[model samples]
Target: MKQFLRSGVVAATLAVAGVSGAGVALAETMNVTIVAGHPPVFRWVKHASQTFIPAVNKALEGSGTTIEWSEQYGGSLAKVGEELEAVEEGLAEIGLVSSLFDPAKLAPQNVTYFTPFVVSDSTLVSEWMDKLQSSNADMKAAWEANGLEYLGGAIGIDDYLLMTNFPVKSIADLEGRKIGAPGPAVNWLKGTGAVGVSGNLTTYYNEIKTGVYDGVIVFASAALPGKLHEVAPYITKVGFGAQYAGGFAANKDWFDGLDPAVQQALRDAAEADRIAYHADLDASVSKFLEIMTSQGATVTEVDEGFRAQWAAGMDNVAKVWAEKLDDAGVNGSAVLKDYMDTMRAAGAQPVRNWDQE
Candidate 1:
């Protein structure tokens, strides 16, 4: 048998002893490597191992196929935002490709971040994005263009909020404040009088404590785990809406050449991973808030009037974003309108009609 290499398919024949002593049953064995920039501590990455791999194993039972999996997480194989490139290059068979970090390649996936205050339901955002990838030509093309296949494990981040040292009774308090936001989320801070800097979960704590930033726009699910509440104890619930961060992707060439049963098994496991991740995330949100509050962090929910003021105070970055993508030939305007309309039809009333502007 030829050795299984890291970059491509590795298949072998395995013989299982027959109980009747008539002969040995032959089965196909494949080696698969999964990668993620995030460690297993995150719900998405955690479920990838706890739920996805187990589910795939169960689905492939009795199918004459067995998968040997190698999980390289926490930047062992690829750092944040590089999973797509790694998979596309065949360094790994599959990966939890984070669109939040890879903005240029996965532009359409950031539609929700551009249009905030739409809805805070992570599950809803995950489901709709998955549907769009299957139905929307441009969205599907984004993955195809990169030589990757979307495999259904949608990573839906919880609603975003502000964690600052200073109290935020109104937008006026944010003036002259240096706030850090992730990726396109910096656009959410436009015209708010605060200076927006690009940042991410990995560095938010030390940055805020060291005076690099006065505050950070983050989510509770991550804030608690990241211990961001310890550094920035004043928590303001902005409800910037849940976001579709990314999804599972496989190397196109490798995935396309797999047996149909193996392919279906991977997809089935990805769906299970999505469901388990969202459930874990949803159950943790309020519980995390309570935990943070007990630890002396003050949590405040902005009233409707204040929320409206915050929404209205921003520039129409959504329009700017769409037009920019449209100029790049990605049909950004259509995606923006489609996302906003879908949310509205699902009974979500935005604080500001970004698409309308």
Candidate 2:
């Protein structure tokens, strides 16, 4: 009886030890909140989270290192204007930021938006951005100074166009017209004689219907879902320049806290998400145009010469922006030149050089 009791005590101790060892070997799980100012319906934010979450989970599968998400869409967490600061302060681990909206924080890199007619293709633009990030340490340092790191980026809506209450066939038609444009887009209206009113996509539908503005500067992909077509049926393809590829940015401190393996997983997921998001966007552009036309929106193709004229008129905003950044003591001029040089090296031809007179 004594021998049997001693054996039972030894067995219990071994079981407890085994459980403790297993716990020690298991990796810790992390919860990351990814915030986007736009609604979930927008492809840039929606598809990124949808595709990225799964890829990350798969990468960490069976490793006991799980990433749970806190997805705040439709400006539920961070308002569109406050995204950069929100992520920097760790309110969100990741965010989808628009450089165009936060030029003060992003500076000369925002020149991409200021320089109209520089990039016509989204794919080439995206590739050029990747090259810029890799080659330009100064650009990365700019984001780092803001306590954020740009992992990768996805394209926003395609080239912007005018969706107005009235048809805009020529630049003369825009004289004194009250046009609603997102903040950075106001530069595109320079010299066009259009009265630029500040607005964002979230309020575009109601503002255009209720406000005194006659039309909005928006892209087809974004306009289709926002139902801007219903309010402004006259779709004018003004050949406005392509926008920068917006994407996943994270709090640098939070990112640095992760294990190296997890860091790589996040980056890989971001890259995959970017590719998938662009594919969906490319398809949606055609589909949205079709839907708008079917819904009685008058889609007019502006003359190619007129498009060139508009591009020429709005070309120098980049230089103006770069000088502003340089004046502020940021390395704005170098960053801008590097980005343009990268685009050129990749066989891209700018409609106009912002650095030139």
Candidate 3:
């Protein structure tokens, strides 16, 4: 579950004396290891191979540098939630780190999850996060402090939808039920009369089938593959908004040690990877929904009134979240307001304005 390899070393060997008395230049290759906690079932994982690795290779094609990729994914390098440590420890050179799972470590990156119902478009959410990470020093420092360099921007999971076995007509149906959510997402269920269990997509199916919990807050991309529809067939498009759960990052030591051109190549490839992943995910949403429905899943979109009820009913989690951050001297309040304003400026209309309220 841990590994490291120099990613794409540009080996230029000077002419060496041989028996023939002719010096030969030897080409050096950098062996770059890329890793992820989730398997290829997720679009991010898939693109890490299909889009990112190749893009990195392509970028270094004529730069006298070639990346020999050692792709270790699906928890082979790090299990779900352990990727950050793996990369930070230099166990792996690069990895897709799940910020959502590492709340204490990556709290600033979870801004979207704290302020829900802001935007539902995955690409837009990702683009905005990219902007924020670059424009805000704290955001970038979060990664640097952790000894990791965030590559490109950040990638996102699709808009979250409620998937459960019980019919979710309104907030009433969910009362007294145990619903699973990862990290801060549990707060979204506040005042909804449902107990939110700390859970991840990997365990949703088994957990739901065994009746460990009633339902889960999940997205179509994972729900279809996890086959959660079989156990939790009731799907609700509650507009929880997309999130920056995880994205590309490299160990600071490894990244800094690489040649500048190679580093730039990796960064460029990661950016291309961001674009490709969003496009693929956007294209797959409807298909996955159809597949799940065909497999007997029931789907519904909560009405505007219902959405407002749900959003308004929740405790002021955003304000509380900001206060906690501010008390820690982390500027959580400013981050919250800035995120809300950014989303609004981009024409987002949340069911409840998390910051203003």
Candidate 4:
């Protein structure tokens, strides 16, 4: 997934055209392809791409620069774990990359997903991320070093919950259960003694049906689209908390090559997409819950004490992650602290600190 920018080829092609131009000849249309690991029905990635592509085209309407899109959703272009590298290597011009799935590449920022019960409000989460991106230099460098540029991001779904074949009434109920969790979510299995099987929202259905696992930890918004209610009817809101999910990124060289106006337009479009996508997700939760319940899913709210117990059970993986990154010469601890401070200022109450709490 590597893309090479050939300035010499462009210049040679322009010279061969017999148009002796003193200035660079810009293309009338820019063919931009956006890739998503999830299916088109996933709200965050789907709606963001849907909202951005049109707004970008509208911004370039009279500029004679048309924005064309090629969306490869449902892991068609890049699988769940391959998004970060796919974008870094320019497999697609732009892509929706998940930090949780690519911890090795995203590290400190990905630690946020591992820190349970840190932030609950999606709006605050999204707003705080915006502030972090603007003020945090290390955060910027983290992405820049990967040959990518972050436009902006959206908060995906709400807090995660456990949807299982058996009702989760207590922490002890989880013992010995083969639970399906994403890579970052495996930390939740600590102390509970639950057998954690790594899986994503995309694979939950088939895995659960085939008896690969007894239950799955996922957000209702995403689980609804996959019809998870039918198979796993017991829903326990264990408060895994809100995740930053993923965001749009482009090849740095390709992004820098764009005109300033076009660059601003693309950024503006992505910001708008972030707001709209989060709002849509916040609204969709209740609607999906109703739909899921009507279809015979038993939705239960876990006791607040139990939720706290679960949050406390997982070790502060953030510090472990930061130390790992520090060994690699990356300033992960500072980035994590700055993000936590910004989130707190934005009205978020973190349950623990990555450095010291």
State the weakest 10-residue window (summed lDDT) of model 1: 1-10
In candidate 3, which residue pairs clash?
1-77, 3-91, 6-31, 7-32, 8-30, 9-30, 11-28
Q: lDDT of all the models against the reference?
A: 0.88, 0.76, 0.84, 0.77
Predicted candidate 1 versus true structure: per-residue lDDT over 1-357, tens digit per residue:
112233332333433473342354556677889999987877788899999999999998887777889999999999888999899888898999998888899998889889989998999889888888878777889998898889998999999999999899888899999999989999888878999999888789999999999999999988988899999999999888899989999888888888788789889889989999999999999999999999999999998888888888888889999999999999999999998888888878888999897
> Which of the numbered candidates is closest to the native, going by highest lDDT?
1
TM-score of each: 0.93, 0.91, 0.93, 0.90
Which segments of model 3 are wrong by more than 4 Å?
Answer: 1-26
Residue range 43-154, candidate 3, lDDT tens digits: 7888888988888888777666676777888888888889999889877788898998888888888888888888889898888887787677767888888988888636
C-alpha displacement of 308 in model 4, angstroms?
A: 2.0
Candidate 4 at 140: error in angstroms?
1.5
Report how far off residue 256 is in candidate 1 (Å): 0.3
How badly does each model clash, as a count of residue pairs? 0, 0, 7, 1
| Count of clashes in candidate 4 | 1
Clashing pairs in 1: none
List, residue by residue over 1-357, the lDDT tens digit for candidate 4: 255533222223555567665686565656677888888878876775678887788787767566657788888999887877877877777788787787777765565675677777777777677556557776677778788888886545488888999988788998899999888787778878799998898889989988998999898888899999888999987777787766777888888888788888888888888888888888888898889999999999877788778767777777777777778988878877777777777777766655565
Better of 1 and 2 by TM-score: 1
Tell me the deviation in Å of residue 88 in model 1. Answer: 0.9
Q: Which stretches of candidate 1 lie above 4 Å from their native place?
A: 1-25
Worst 10 residues of 4 by lDDT: 4-13
- How many clashing residue pairs are found in candidate 3? 7
Give the TM-score (vs. native) of candidate 2.
0.91
